[model samples]
Target chain A: MKPPKTDSSDFILSVQNLNAWYHTTQVLQEISFDIQRHKVTALIGPSGCGKSTLIRCFNRMNDFIATFKLAGQILLEGQDLYDPAIDPVEVRLRVGMVFQKQNPFPKSIYENVAYGPRISGIRRRHQLDAIVEESLKRAALWDEVKDKLKANAYTLSGGQQQRLCIARTLAVEPEVLLLDEPCSALDPIATAKIEELILKLKDDYTVVIVTHNMQQAARVSDFTAFFYLGELVEFWATDKIFTVPKDPQTEAYITGKFG
Target chain B: MNSTRQIKMRLIRQKWGDQVFQTIAVIGVLIALTTLAALLIDALSDGLPRIDWKFLTSFPSRKPAKAGIFSALVGSLYLITLTALIAVPVGVAAAIYLEEYTSQNSRINRIIEVNIANLAGVPSIIYGLLGLEVFVRAMRLERSLLAGALTLALLILPIIIISAREAIRTVPNSIREAAYALGATRWQTIQDHVLPMAFPGILTGIILSVSRAIGETAPLIAIGALTYVAFLPDGLRSPFTALPIQIYNWVSRPQKGFHTNAAAGIVILLALTLLLNALAIFLRNHYQKKHS
Candidate 1:
């Protein structure tokens, strides 16, 4: 591994000389980048370009895969996340994630949001109620679901279900949010709503999103990281990357000439 | 025009094959249902007259007309209760360990999975012999109710584990990941989410296995459960007799009255089994409707 980079306080996450593989097949090689605090960073690439894999490494979700192997330093708040003394569970609690598909539990809407706080030892009913209400409000879903908190989560529409999942993750009060193509399954109206929520969320939490839509990256992200074939092709301010990308491959991809 | 004629002919041949297979399948179903109906009719015709309040309450006697299944019925009930108490927890725990705690690709878990599948197919008589040696002799329980229950527990443990594993496996991995993302420990995830979701399925498996254990006689007989139990089993230590053992004994006798009594016993056993199966189906449907 290369010498550790100086990770300043402005950066909430920093990856240095990272290499990752699933068993014998390498998926990412020599990836290094720093994610700024309270800013939205979009990792954009075509399918099979390892963008998703790199995002998953933010909170160690890939630890569940038995064949996955990694050799690198992932620092969260200037502390090595992979240190033996640190538990992966703690890392996950501090860094929440929302999946591409809406995965609300087969429970009440209230219970779905309260689940995270409950597992963290918050048992008082009023306290949970407050957290659930606040989280749902922050996710921009309270106006529609406040009256039906007792209803089963499956009763909600596809877009509402996805926002409920966001509320569920937010109840844990994480400092960072990782979203893996969070709106790929939704229609344009729902996508616009979620994009608005992401912009609002960056005021309080650092956001790292993996999306294939170049327009989405340009609209929501402050910084855009372009990945191609397991390598970081280019990373810069979203405005500069779209208008004056230094790499010819990055320009070719953004222009829709070839993916 | 020639190619179109050939296609028409191929369609006709396909329809003929389909009709033939449908006919064979219908025949197969008819054969199974008719055989079952014939046995029930025969048993009801012979035994319906003998089944009364007096017959149900009376104890066995030397005279076949005075014999009843009071002791055997009670003993069978007691035996199954004990067996379920011993087997359900152990079986469900073993299933959870195999499904959740161990990685699916581990060599040890693979060996265990194959062994459990093979065990489910093993003859019940082998479990009887095992119980005879382990519980009856080595543990010094003798041919008592405890020994019989332990033997039957062994007989159905494999079935329970296999079914429980299937039930637990039905809970999607997405749910587990959701729980883990919230910082829930492995056991906490299983207890709060996995077990509750799998409860209906696990209950169905337990009931089915218990019903099988109730009908078991080879293992009970192998462990030396008495055939002429005159009194109800007082406790786990008391010697007992089951309905199958009593039915077997009466069927062997030359007297016609004993044959009628055996038929009555078979009817009762069949009713009990059907009732348990109906309960299992009812519970599964109830939960399915609630969830879906």
Candidate 2:
């Protein structure tokens, strides 16, 4: 098999013939794709289709699972992510993630945002304060939480909490942000707000989002990949995939004929 | 119409069963409370007159009226404090390793977990024997406060580890994942997020175990804690007598006045346990409020 071009300026992440398994059960099969730099790429599939598993692989979040195993390679700007000398912690630093459910630390709002910086050994109060403000502002949550920065993070509304998690991720200054169905727990309004944030974030960070919602993929992503039964059935520009999908399964899924 | 009537009858029977369960539970609570109250009242009635400033300030004597628990009380305090200082850090670190670092499916970890649980159930007297053989004889610490403290520390280490593990497990995996996704190493994740979140629970466990250590008699006696220490322990190596040992010695005497002193010793020991429990509850609530 020919190696995928990594020197291309457009792509920031490349997955080549990746196969993933949880113990004996394979969840992703021979998946290959490139995430465009500074663009949102959405992974859309049904519940068991391995979309979330693929997103987790980008930042090595799946490393925590005892039975998780994978073959093939994931490259970040041509560097092998699974190389023995490269630490998972370093991978996560460059590629941050947000989970499906909102998970702000059980700390004050300001502390929640500053946690990443603190863990990275930043000690000066002034430095942390600036990072907190900037990250929260970028998440579009600064105005709502600024007055009550000391309030517990659990006090925030679901949407605001989700944004706080996003701000927490941004504080580490990652180059790529992988959001695993981040709006699944939110109401329509909250989902819309997060979708808006994702769009704004694409200008600065490469984004890979997994969503069950077809319209969300259409609205936020530049490219969309459709997975079916652990296989990539189609990958194309978001408009073309929705309008004229080459795979019948992809078309059927987007049209709500079946999961 | 017949089926509807049957349904109504079944609902009424179910409600009666619910009431019966509640009544049984209430009866259980009443029985426990009454026994505790009776014991407290009996101890206070017998010992209240003997408890005075002089009683607290004096030492044990052949004359029952002149005897006090001053040395024993101080020794008990020192023992529990030392036991906590030794047991807490060791227990919590062991718990963290078992919970966070090791795979639950591994054979060695499963064996270790089972042994720790078994250790919690092992009799305290057995711990006394171990302490006697190890700290007192082999280590040549003699019948000193340090030996007694080491014995009690071993006695409660299992309980502390069990509770600390439970506390650490309660810190949701989501919080851990959040910490890791920000590039935090495993230790960093534990130090910054996991430990702080589990702090309240760990503290409650530590205090509860320390209180148990304070009331322990068999282990200390088995390790040969002095039954009558007239002078205070000057340091860790000095001979010591805890309240329980002092009480045991007093109760065995034929003199009625000595029995009264025994009751007074029981009262003070009970008070210390209650105070420690109250502190545990307070700190648990305070930290829970702050963390959440």
TM-score of chain A of each: 0.96, 0.96
Residue B229 local lDDT, model 2: 89
lDDT of 2 at A63: 87
Q: Which ten residues in a row have the lowest lDDT in candidate 2 chain A?
A: A1-10
- Fraction of true interface contacts that also occur in model 2: 0.96
Report the C-alpha lDDT of model 1 over B1-292, residue by residue, as the tens digit: 5699899999999999999999999999999999999999999988888898877777888899999999988888999999999999999999999999888899999899999989999999999999999999999999999999888888889999999999999998888878877777788889988888898999999999999999998998899999998899998899999999999999999999999999999998988899999999999888866664
Instruction: List CA RMSD, all candidates.
Output: 2.3, 1.9
Off by over 4 Å in 1: A1-9, B1-4
lDDT of 2 at A20: 96
The whole-model C-alpha lDDT of candidate 1 against the native structure comes to 0.90
Score candidate 1 by TM-score against the native: 0.96
lDDT tens per residue, model 2, A1-259: 2222344557789899999999999999999888889989999999999998999888898988999999999999999898889999999999999999999999899999998899889999999999999999999999998999999999999999999999999999999999999999999999999999999999899999999888999999988999999998888889888999878998999999998
